[model samples]
Target: MRYDVNLSILFTELPMLERPAAAARAGFDAVEMWWPFDGPTPADAELDRLAGAVTEAGVQLVGLNFDGGHMPSGDRGLLSSPATSRRFRDNIDVAVGFAERLGCRTLNALYGNRTDDTDPELALENLALAAKAAGGVGATVVVEALNSFENTRYPITSSAQAFQLLDQVPGTAFLADFYHLGRMGEDLSALIANHADRFGHVQIADVPGRGQPGTGELDYAAILRQLADSPYDGHVGLEYKPVGPSEESFSWLEAMP
Candidate 1:
């Protein structure tokens, strides 16, 4: 299976544009992002520059996360508060353009939550609308499931829930996050095997501190084995923060299988 490291977290010392090169030097085939927006909004020039950097690095932009507000105290993404839906949709277009420029085929659509004023059906409809738009640009949208205990604002917590919501959208698929799945007390192998075809991408983070795979309770071996056995074939996104130096943190992956 090809590896996809999140450039933002993996190489925190470098500029975002230079991250792909660092990932390439580490023997990774591709790179991803939690989110690449410079601010609450998207910028055309910045997106162009990022796309250029990816091409220059000789690595693929395997995944692009559309989950906005991923930064500290920043809020506004595909599924944020009701008032931000318009801005969110605009950002979706910008994200697709950026992905297209980078030759990326998959884009993550993280569902942001609003507990006070929004209805579930409305949010689902909005998600469907966004998915359809993403599909138009030849970029598949994968709905992300984050453990609520860790990512408090993430609306979908379980693989089952993610599948249910994604099912509402004709072409949208699932993203099984290992760290979140473990945190929610779900069976990682079972979830992956059951929804093999529906899964478009995956992410990793060890519990206890969200470190490398080998440092936590997660069975990276079993997870990789299950993926090998399943029909799914996609990039495994590394989304955890490095406990020490970035280059030293990836030693755990050598023992993944």
Candidate 2:
């Protein structure tokens, strides 16, 4: 499995624009990120400058997320919210355009937290729109399961739940994030054994602590072997929070089977 650092989480020691270069210096030719802007539609110049930085750093931007509203405040995503539907729609072009500019072919749309009155249909509608927009650039829209313990209000807390929602949206794919799935008590070996052919992207952090592989109870060695033997061929993203300086967190990668 090819690996790419998740710049949003891994390289926070530097300014946002410098993270790509940091990844390159650390021997990574590819990187991915959560949305880096405060708002969905950043000015063209801001977008250009960021694109230029990634280009100059000589690393490929492999994946990106849509604008999830106010992430630090626990707002998971916007696509499903009736109040934010317009905002989510408006961001589709800008996000996909940025992905296109950098040759990134995968876009992830986190299903938002559900409220007492949330409509699942609305979420599906918005996701379909996202899938269609991404298709224009030959990119795919992937959905992942987030653990309910941390994401309290977020729906789709298991791979099963995520697939239930994704089932209705054709041509879309699954984002197998082992960190959240393991938190939900998913059997990593079983998941790869069964659904490896359907994965569009993969992210991993250890169970319990959400840190690098050895920081918690995850059996990454077995999981890596499963992925290696399966038909799934894609980037495995290191999406964990580092225990110390981000650069120090990757000793585990060298140990990958």
Candidate 3:
């Protein structure tokens, strides 16, 4: 199974631009990250600096997230936020352009938490816009579900919930984030077998702690074995938060069957 490190989570001990090299040093050849700036559109030089760091590290950027507003502040994303619709629209082409430049083909668009103002029709429209923008540059736009316990306001929290969006918007793909799904007590193996065809980009973090695999209850070896046998063939993103120093958290990688 080919794996790509999520630089945004894995190498936080280092500077943002420095994480790519750190990931490379830890033996990863491909990496992914959330938008690398506080704003949707950063200065050209800032983008240049990040691109240079990735290129210099000799790693392929395989996946990227559309600019979701400040995540730590509990803003899940702008895709379906009525108050932030303009910001989400303004970010689509810019994100797609950067992804094309980095040879990345998968772009994840996080669905915002459901608010009193949430509009289902507006959300579908934004998702369609994102799908079209990414298609223009030969990239696929992926939608992901988050667990409700922590993301209490986020609407799409189950594999079935995320898969339902695929029918509403053609060309929209599903991002199966195992951590969130697992935390919700979903039958992962059964879901993998059933929805294998819709899997676009997959991410994993052991639940109960959101740490690397093997640190929590998930049997990654068995899960991975099943994933390897499934029809879905895409990079399994290591998107877990580490227990300690990020570099030291990869022992599971070598031990995985």
Candidate 4:
């Protein structure tokens, strides 16, 4: 099981432009990120600089998110929002282009919060459109489940909800984040056994506090062993919050198989 740092969370002490090198210095060869800018599209020069940073650091960018509107703040995603559908549509090409240039193949499309006026049909349609666009670039779209506690407005807060959306989008797959699922009290072991083949990528953080693996109760060794035996052949993204300095949080990496 290869491990990749999620630069969006780790090495956040540095400027976004300096993080890839910082991650490389910390001994990571691959990284993943959320959409790093506030808007759906950033200037071409900014994209070029970010791409250059990763390239210069000699790290592979394995995954990225589509503009999931102001993450950790308010909206979880724009794709499903009737008001922001146009922004979501406009972002697809630019996001796909960045992934292509960075050699990142997995793109996580977050399902937005469900409003009183939100139409489920429209959300499905938008997701399908996003998946089709990503497929054209030889990439796979991934839908992830966030915990309802933190993402109360986000509709797809469980694996079941995520699967339902994936059914509507033909070529997309699931991103099984253990921390979120575990927080929702899903049986992690059984989920892996039943849906391993459906997973495009996997992310991990210990539950309770969303800290690094050992800081909480998750049995990562057992989970990793299960993953190794399962059909999923992908990197496990370290998408946890650092308890101390980000560099010190990596002690758990030595324990991983």
| lDDT (CA) per prediction | 0.77, 0.91, 0.90, 0.90
Superposed on all Cα atoms, model 3 deviates from the true structure by an RMSD in Å of: 0.9
TM-score, each model?
A: 0.93, 0.98, 0.98, 0.98
What's the lDDT for candidate 2? 0.91
Per-model C-alpha RMSD = 1.8, 0.8, 0.9, 0.9
Q: Which residue window of length 10 is worst by lDDT in model 4? A: 72-81
Query: Residue 245, candidate 4: how far off, in angstroms?
Result: 0.7
Mind giving the per-residue lDDT tens digits that candidate 1 earns over 1-257? 77888987789899898888888888887988867775435666777778778888888888887746545663425464576566566676777777787778888876766457556766677677767777887878887777777567666788878877877788888887788888898987778777788888888888867888877887788888889779888888888888888878888777665
Candidate 3 lDDT by residue in tens digits, 68-104: 8989899988877689889989898889989999899
Query: Which pairs clash in the backbone of model 3?
Result: none
Write down the lDDT that model 3 would get.
0.90
Please report the candidate that would top lDDT against the real structure: 2
In candidate 4, what are the lDDT values of residues 1-257, reduced to their tens digit?
Answer: 88899999998899998999988998889999999977888999889999999999999999999998877678888877689888888899999999999889999988788887687787788888888888988899999999989988888878998898888779999999999999999999999999999999999999889999988889998999999899999999999999999988988877778
Screening candidate 2 with a backbone cut-off below 3 angstroms (N, C-alpha, C), the clashing residue pairs are none
* lDDT score at residue 73, model 2, on the 0-100 scale: 96
Candidate 4 off by > 4 Å: none
Candidate 4 at 1: error in angstroms? Answer: 0.8
Where is model 2 more than 4 Å wrong at Cα?
Answer: none
